[model samples]
Each structure stands twice: as C-alpha cells, then as structure tokens.
Target: MRQLLAPALLVAGLLLSGCAGFQPLYAQPGVTRDLGAIEVTAPAGRTGYLMRQHLDDAFAKNHSVAPRYTMDLALAEARYPRGVRIDNVATRYEYVLTVTYVLKDLPSGAVARRGRVRVELTYDSADQPYASISAQQDAQDRATDEAARRIELELAAWLGTTAKVAAK
Candidate 1:
C-alpha cells in the first residue's frame, strides 16, 4: 500500500504541474510598459484623491515619459450604520466605494476599455470620537487600496491579452 501511494502521489503532482501554465501578468512582454504609460484622472474629493494616488502607485507611472493612455475615473462613496446600540448609536459602520473608469488611447483619442470596481469595508465605531474617526479613515484607506489593486489587475489582464492578440 505504501509503494502504491507514493507512485500515485508522484504521478498526481506531475500531472497537476503540467496543467498549470500560470504566469505573472506584469511580467509578460509590453504589459509592464503599458501599465507605466497610463495616466489617471480622478474626480474631486478625498476619496478621489486617495484613489488617484493608489492608482498611480499601482501603475508605476513614469514622470519622464508622456502617457500613452489616459484613464478617467469617477468615484462615489457611501457609508451605512450597522450594529446599532440600544440607545440608537451605531456600533459598526459599512463603507462602500464605487469607481467607474474609462481608458482611452491618447493619440487616437479612442476609448479602449471601460470598467467599474466596487470595494466594501466594515469598521467598528469606538466610544471615543477621535478613535471612531480614525477607524473610519483607516477603512477608507483600505477600501481605496483594494479598489486600486482590482483596477490594476483588470488592466494588466486586458493588456496581456491585447498584446497576445496584436502579436499574432
């Protein structure tokens, strides 16, 4: 039984390894360059500011080079109270951020892609006012980071596939 189990496990491992062709998206040819060439334009507000900063970091935009693509972003944020106390005070809150974006080719001025991403987070409302404010700010930061990551992934995937198609 031991000999049979070892052989079966080895075979399974080899088969599974062959099935996986996983490759990092940014590592693909042209994908990283394309990401670095994108410029983001976000709406006016704190949430928009956060999203723009996060997106710039994720895209690794280069200041020296002119952007090849422009991404226009519209952001909306909403907060809802949850876990209400007996006195009608809220013990927890949910933060929801929704972003809609359009990617356009700079020279051609043509829309390349359009997508939306939503991020939701929950935070506890502390008794202290400052602590509660701090917690809410932290939640907003986390949500913005998450939204930026999602946008990066979506753009990378699109760029990777488009590069492949263009190559062929």
Candidate 2:
C-alpha cells in the first residue's frame, strides 16, 4: 500500500507542477486584436496574389479601421526537375517558395519584426502540358498556404511575448 501511494502522489505532483506557469499563447489579451490590425502587402504575381489572400484570411483584417502595422513581403519562387528519365526527360519536379517579411509600426514608422518562411513541394510531371501546368499550380497553392500559416503563428507568438514584456 505504501509503495503504490508514493507513485500516485509523485505523478499527481508532476501533473500539478506542469500546469503552474503554463499560458496559452493565443489566449493572451489583445493577440487576436493585434493580428487583425496588420495590413499585408505582397509582390505582384500569381504567387503573390495567393499569399496575400491567405494572409488576409488568417489575419481577419478589417478595412474599415486604420491599420496599426503594415507587413511587406518579398517573394521568390523556383522550380527544379527532380527525377529524370533515361532520355533526360523530367518525371518529377520540386517547387520552392520563399517569402521574407518585414513588419512595421505605422504610428512610429519603425520596424517591429522581420521573419522569413519557406515551403517546398513536389509534384509529378505529366506528358500532357495542361496536366503539368495544373500540377505546378496546385503545388504553388499549397506552398503559399503553408507559408501563410507559419507566418501567422510566428507573428502571434511575437505579439504575445511583446505584450507580456510591455505589461511587466
């Protein structure tokens, strides 16, 4: 009975300690509001357009109110042939999309945060031209969506920590 009780108490103590100082990042006050206030500017092209759409959705921007911060993104895209056949024809391709972003405070015109997010995707190359193009477009969409998600997470974390620091 003593041995069993000791292990149970240890487990309970460990569980209680784990919850002592744990705070959910997104639950911090004003994180969602801060995110919604950012305006995103992306380059001009299909990839840029897709990225902008994703970011706008993620931020839930409200155009009626003035923005507190602006984010500028520089996007680069590249594609490489991954697998080649005996006759030097490509069978698979790799697509890489990278975006470097700078977040600036609109009020003070100072840079608040800078980050880069990159995503790589692979798609099979088809003999039909239309099919190949469709596959590449699908990859581009996926890469842009993933990059947007990562950027949103990073920005939320940064905003959360900044709020904490300011509070202290």
Enumerate clash totals for all models, in the order shown: 0, 0
| True-structure lDDT of candidate 1 | 0.93
lDDT by residue for model 1 (1-168), tens: 998999999999999898798777776789989899999998888778999999999998888889999999988889999999999999999999999999999999899999999999899999999999999999988999999999999999999999888889
User: For model 1, where is the 10-residue window of minimal lDDT?
Assistant: 19-28
Mark the regions of model 2 whose C-alpha exceeds 4 Å error after superposition: 1-17
Q: In terms of TM-score, which candidate is strongest? A: 1
Task: Tell me the tens digit of each residue's lDDT in model 2 across 1-168.
Answer: 998999999999999998988899888887888888999999999999999999988888878778999999999999999899999999999999999999999989799999999999899999999999999999999999999999999999999998898889
**Backbone clashes in model 1:** 0
**Candidate 2 local distance difference test against the native:** 0.93
TM-scores for the candidates: 0.89, 0.88
